[model samples]
Target: MKSPQDWPEPIVRVQSLSDSGISTIPNKYVKPPIERPSLSNSFNNDINIPTIDFLGLFTSDGNNYANKSIIYEQISEACRNWGFFQVVNHGVPPELMDEAREVWREFFHHPMDVKQTYANTPKTYEGYGSRLGVEKGAILDWSDYYFLHYLPCSLKVHNKWPAFPLSLRKVIEEYSKQVVKFCGRLMKILSSNLGLKEDVLQNAFGGDRDIGACLRVNFYPKCPQPDLTLGLSPHSDPGGMTILLPDQHVAGLQVRRDGHWITVKPASHAFIVNIGDQIQVLSNAIYKSVEHRVIVNSAEERVSLAFFYNPKSDLLIEPVKELVTKQNPPLYPPRTFDEYRLYMRTKGPQGKSQLGESDKSQDEK
Candidate 1:
């Protein structure tokens, strides 16, 4: 039995595990005794999640007003109840989505050295790596990922970006532009649902040029003991919102609702949208930032692209004034993006949103 120190210096990528041709969970990959569990036993497949159609929202005819109102109501219900929903006709060209996935698949299949050239480090959030938090005895997840900061294009570090698979950069850049626009429009609808001006939420993010966004491409390979390990640890997103493009054929993402773990099935050309911790705080806790996790498959691999929309680093986040009155005071205190990120780095993902943890820590202090 080897300790975590004996593991590879840079940490082994999940793709390497798939390439080894081994059939059993390696000793190093086995989680701590206290953390191990039968993942198969926790699933509840009876509940059906909601899916929203965006095609009607973009129409220019006489029914547009009615369609927009209905769609806004549906989105509000989903956010308040489940904090998750799927959107079809989202306007991101299917061809571009397909090409983006193809390029990423090709990039991940490159030689280990090729991927390692852009390895992530403590100082930078971008690049390729595994086991983000390497604390001793920690239960590491079973996924490898490439992360890049997208919005505020000026903040992008050209050196940290991957230069392989040829078309990887081009496809991602174009896709990012489209997703950001779509997210902005979605924010407007959310703001209107909350009885605020159409641009209230978008404006709070520090205008179009100052907002921040990140793109994370995740790859989860088949695990020998799938029931004993997780593709990702259970946690809630710390940003404002997330637009996720999951593999159409594979399923592993799950959300916890009413103490039951429900699987999120993928729909053709649809993006899974979930409210994040910041959004919950901005809404004064009216909207939930639900806990979700990924389970590994034993026979097939899974991949997903997650776009995290956030506010500017210097922007202070707090409950919107309109949403906070005598009946509903602010649920979370004001905090900057930098402060929130530092808290998440220290606590890691542990089945709860960072905002909740931050509030608890403040109360205790």
Candidate 2:
């Protein structure tokens, strides 16, 4: 009987893509870390991430569209005004978030020698990396992470998961399942708000074709000078939606709102959610994928789990015609996430993954 921690290692087999017979996965759009001249006196240290009470948003004691009315209002505000919000009572249990974090810490805390076995290097983009903005001459961001592409379960190959946690596999597997459900529920809410059937967006994902999910477990090691380090660079997520669960009490997440950056204060039990590019296209760009970034602290390191929810690579993403009436013509042409991803890869690490403005600019004479 093979246990979760002691199962025989399975050889990772990946198809060769280039001249050299090595496996390659899609790498992230890298960007140089932005540096500030000094920890300024005027810079905002007072801002925080917006918080939304699910109970307040979905008032249970309502009828017919009552529940939806509350959700619609808050969702619209979060999307249009703030572009980000911390979601509580999201239906994903708090216990699950806790378990996922425990497993992540276990793997990260493994000795450097044990962790290095998964070193991604230049060949395979599937393993591990320290710091962001890895390109030469780019200022590095202060963060360490383990990246995994999970979905189509077969595609999931264990790299260097911790060997001691008894419930590691069960916990992660269950958590991933729950995330898929959360993504579905959110799509339906957005769809209804977009004047489409509840299933409009969900159907765009195709019947049980399995959505794409990319997970990054980040460990922000304590910095000697937190003012000099960034847990994550200022960038937009490149998927349909991003689900984040941060350290319980620490405050580091922030989103660019209005013209200012607002902090995303950590809540006791919540999953901070942010929309991404695919949804922007499907929703006619009305619900935007906001620009968000992270800041580090000088005292303690922060740990976060970011799950990127995306449609299948082959799905055609076009603005729903139903949402575009006489007043609102289709904002974007049909395109696939795969193509957008290719364009971004070639564009190099600018962190601007959205194509809305770029497409519009090209359309103009």
Candidate 3:
């Protein structure tokens, strides 16, 4: 699909409104009545996503094997049942996580002109952005974000990353390195969980060197009418999986479960992990990409770092040969990651068709 030269309309930074002290949000940011975050019991639920400890699961020397079997099943269960989980005792240092998140927070709080230098376009979406999709007049989310690539080496341009925070580039470089390493470990776990060789999933993702990994740092500004609009629209991630370092001070991410929306409680010094559509495709639906959205808080602004690990853009991804059987066959047609995401970027990821009619996002009202 060919992309437009630029955004369909002029971009408006959501953080500006929060700073301007507006009592009410712009009409363009309002969601349909059915899509708004409601406080009634019918909409919110008491359920919480699973939290798994990685304390003994993975070590530099080698797997404990004893602890490996236990935590392995926990991750498998979480992927099958909830498509989401929180992981603690992960190898990434706590100090680094805090530093990585704080640097982005400081960048968002900077003056508009400073952040605008890297303003992004619909073509690549590689720098600062305020909205998703180029759909003109689309109702927008109450957030601003910075998107940058990390994998494929060709695309990891240090100059493109924010520089004023001084330490921002260094932190992101180290942060991406650690997170990608963990993702590789998780891929092995997923393969083992599916009774396949440890490298099956990794190989399917174009091997480690050719993988697609990127980061989108979302800054959700406090909104006056939080209930009337969402910080992000409802959708499953289009990539393989997401490793999110959430804002511990404020809770806003919500996962849909049994037709109810459940807010996630951040685990201290932990990373939230969730399955995405690519894995679901590769798993042949043994796991799923859970539909999730972020709600804005009127009392507090929030920032999250979402690291997406995906297959190489041009590699055709399909259900693994092992997962396919005469009983099930291939549920989804083979499609490249490039072909899959083009639909999302143009049609928007708000429960729209991803790869075809077979891969439509859940449209639960």
Worst 10 residues of 3 by lDDT: 356-365
Query: Per-residue alpha-carbon lDDT of model 1 for 1-365, expressed as tens digits?
Result: 11232223447777788779778776656765544446333555566568999886876888688888888899999988889999999899999988887788788888898888887754455788676544555667889999898878787775667788777787898999999999999998888888899888888888788899999899998888887778887778888899999988998888766655678888898999999888888888788888778888788988899999998877899999999889778889998876666555555577554665542332222
Query: Cα deviation of 52 in candidate 2 (Å)?
Result: 3.2
Cα lDDT tens digits, model 2, 1-365, are 11122112222211111112323221221232333313322136766556666664434554636666766778877775555778888778888899899788787666666666776533223556653322344445557677777775666775444344667767877888898787777777777777788888877766455677778788776544455545665556666888998888677776655545566778787888888778878888688776666776656667898887887877888887777878988877888877665554333223344564532231231
* Per-prediction TM-score: 0.91, 0.78, 0.95
Ranking the candidates on TM-score from highest down gives: 3, 1, 2
TM-score of 2: 0.78
Clashing pairs in 2: 30-349, 48-263, 48-264, 49-263, 49-264, 49-265
For every candidate, C-alpha RMSD to the true structure in Å:
4.5, 9.1, 2.2
Clashing pairs in 1: none
Error of 1 at 87 (Å): 0.2
Per-residue C-alpha lDDT of model 3 across residues 189-226, encoded as one tens digit per residue: 99999999999999999998999999999999989999
Clashes of each: 0, 6, 0
- Give the number of the best model, judged by lDDT: 3
**How far in Å is the alpha carbon of 136 misplaced in model 3?**
0.9
